[model samples]
Target chain A: MKGPAISIQDLHVSYYGNEAVKGVSLSVETGNLVGIIGPNGAGKSTFLKAMLNLIPKDKGDVKVMGRTIKEVRKRIAYVPQRNDIDWDFPITVLDAVLIGTYPHLKLFRRPKKKDKEWAMQCLQRVGMQDFSKRQIGELSGGQQQRVFLARALAQQADLFFLDEPFVGVDVSSEETIVKILKELCRQGKTVIVVHHDLSKANDYFNQLILLNKELIGFGTVEEVFKPEVIKKAYKGQFAFMNEIGVSL
Target chain B: MAFIEAVMQYGFLQKALLTSVMVGIICGVIGCFIILRGMALMGDAISHAVLPGVAISYMLGINFFFGAVFSGVLTAIAIGFVSQNSRIKHDTSIGIMFTAAFASGIIIITMLKSSTDLYHILFGNVLAVRSSDMWITLGISLIVIAAVYLFYKELLVTSFDETMAAAYGLPVRFIHYFLMTLLTMVTVASLQTVGIVLVVAMLITPAAAAYLLTERLWVMIFLAAGIGVVSSIVGLYFSFTYNLASGATIVMAATSIFVLVFLFSPKHGLVWKTLRVKKKRASLV
Candidate 1:
């Protein structure tokens, strides 16, 4: 429980014999906002899923809070990609957030009023308490993302995994989500985000993980956010950097 | 007046009414999860797949409910296993399993009993309901209601977002199979009223209509159950009065309600959408 919040050693994944993530090993300590960054199809999401064991790993070991995932699953929370779920489902924002409390409850037990209060607080943190009574499908993309974040928060998890939280999200909601995730880190929770926008990476996370189907770089923003490293991971396709100015 | 008098005077008529209503309610309740999970075709497959069990039960001289449930559950599991373990999609597996089971059932039933018995199983004859069949339907109804009531959140989460459910360490596969089992039971219970061919109508139409009426699952369940109960009552009334086939009448009733909701429900209806558009144009003018 005292070691790195997440530790993965030589993680590997494959689909149809083609490697997706090949030998990814990193140690992320507690109480930091970490970002996983790479070009598209670099297996950034694959690494997270492999770590969570949401998918099978050809070879790897992941330890969260010095414990195996199966042993400490309750202490973990995951916000899957926006497209992973049916947004048209007949669920209110509050009810969706209340799912966060499920892991802590006994089987066949509904969320109590106290848990409802906590779920509301989580929604309040993301500035979405006003929409608690609304159905999720009526919300904008950003609002939907925030609802998912609020759901994750209701878990009161020590380690968080968010996959592409900003894809298709409105700008203000993305800003709001980043603020809440940083605040969670300050409150001693480890937050991991799979983010694609390299321009915002330097400002968003204290710890950076540069992945390209492998661990290209893993360290502080100053140590690994270099243009050379980005080029190596992106296979020297830095032309996009010319458009966005790399922001460093 | 005649229908009401018939219902009160004849014990068998009362039993038929009760059985269909129970079938209606459970189908609506369980169908909410089924549609929400995008397993409507699976519902169809299970309903048809129960035919083999009915045929086997007839052969063995045993109650058909157990045989029906056994065959339905087995078909459900087989569909799941084939889909999960192979490149074939769920719809493909469902098509294969249901047809095979249904054909075998027809062959066996035609060989064992006269075609008249086969006609009743395929088309249903609620007016001939027996005491034991009614009791079995009641028991299964209670179990479905209790299971849904106790595990509302679990079912909701799993149905809406399976990955999140798995992340919470809920047994996602177990829940899937558990739902399949409940679906089979509901399908089996509906045998005497809707028959295997039209049981999927009771299972899907009411729930889908309710889906357009509300955005909350609890409200959807209640609305669907209400719709189902009404359909059963109306279908039975017409069937008894006109000497029509009960199964077809019940399915038609449910489908008619679904059509009305599709056109006129407040939020997701075609009429409402058109009305809102017209209102916006008027304001611009």
Candidate 2:
């Protein structure tokens, strides 16, 4: 009765010139929280971009809930890395979150009353309701991350793709985001996050996809976090275990 | 007294005054966003680019306004497309386009052998503002202001973090083009009042001054518009009394206000803050 929420078959992606992801096939089941961990330049961000159709994939088939990406695009939400934003922009937190509803609005139609209500609820869910009126430039790093999470929540999607959501988040923001993502999984939504930290990977994710410009492993965290898989994924560039203690 | 009444009573003067007011308000309003989006330089290039269209239209004996709008919009779209696709930097693209357009206008004007002076294009004669020009300015300004208010959030979101906004499904590309189109329209409409050379002063100064005063977008727009109107009136008065160029005078007035705000504004202002800091350190010692 259960089916995969997100399925990618023979996905291929390239940057300006070189191929980054080649023949990568994977499927994420519904109601699962999947952590995609990889070293720097390991195609983690590229994979998410390809899935979102942000970048054109050289070759692949991507589907959501057994439907092609085009059919289910409105049911997917994304949160990119926080550092990719210009902090000096002139907008309030509420305004930023309100953007999540723009895709559904008719061309040239302004945000309706119900849109504002839904946005406010999402902000409240992220515990950023108090700062809704504040200009985004004034928020702290963690608060800004929370606002982004709130915007994603406003999309009301069944599948969420987060690119390094906790990259620079403070402890509180990290905890808050983890809690929200876990709650989404509990509610039968599929949550896929591109994460870097190896220590908390097992604790936060039920399933794992270890990548290093290749699909090193994809399975339950217990089955995929073996020493050999970790070594291949991290490339022994540094002794992560001694620095942060055992792989998750 | 009879001469004074004669000049003041002219219908053209009335229209010019109204046109200048509308142009000032619209530029002050849209220019705030332009400055915040870091496109003041782009706006400068776009204003100059309108000249070629004006000259070409004159050569073809067509409506000059239509020519300017057509050329300005085309230039805006070209710049946008090229800047995104080419390896060159955005400023470089703008610079290249600006020179090409300016040179084209000069060559066209020289070829046409028209009696219309370059000063009328470069510096603008506010005294010559006509009823048709006023109507065009008012019409475009209203549309610009309405669009801005309706999509304030979307524009701000895209301007701030385009990639993130796109990820959040905000149609970032659409808003980017939309904003650029508005900026081009505003620049084209303002050419009659401030001219290209000095129009940027009006476009940038008020917003820059407002920036030093507050971090809020709406507040900055309001303050900038107020400053623009006051400077326009003062500049007009000065030009009338001194028998100087009205457009240049208006631009100079705006620049002078910016200088004042830069020096005397309380927070982040250049002059008063420096003195205050020195006084505090002296007291502490």
Cα deviation at B254, candidate 2, in Å, is: 2.2
| lDDT of residue A23 for candidate 2 | 84
Model 1, range A1-248, lDDT digits (tens) per residue?
44599998999999767899999888999998999999899999988888988888999899989989988899999999988889889989999999899989997888899999999999998999999999998899999999999999899899999999999999899999999999899889999999987878999999999998989999999988997888788875677666787533
Docking quality band of candidate 2, CAPRI definitions:
acceptable
Docking quality category of candidate 1 according to DockQ thresholds = medium
Show pairs that collide, candidate 1: none
What is the lDDT, from 0 to 100, of the residue A173 in candidate 2? Answer: 82
Instruction: Please report, as a residue range, the 10-residue window in candidate 2 chain B with the lowest summed lDDT.
Output: B1-10
Interface RMSD of each: 1.0, 3.0
Predicted candidate 1 versus true structure: per-residue lDDT over B124-223, tens digit per residue = 8898989999999999999999999998888988998888888768888899989999999999888889888898899999999999999899999999
Worst 10 residues of 1 chain B by lDDT: B113-122
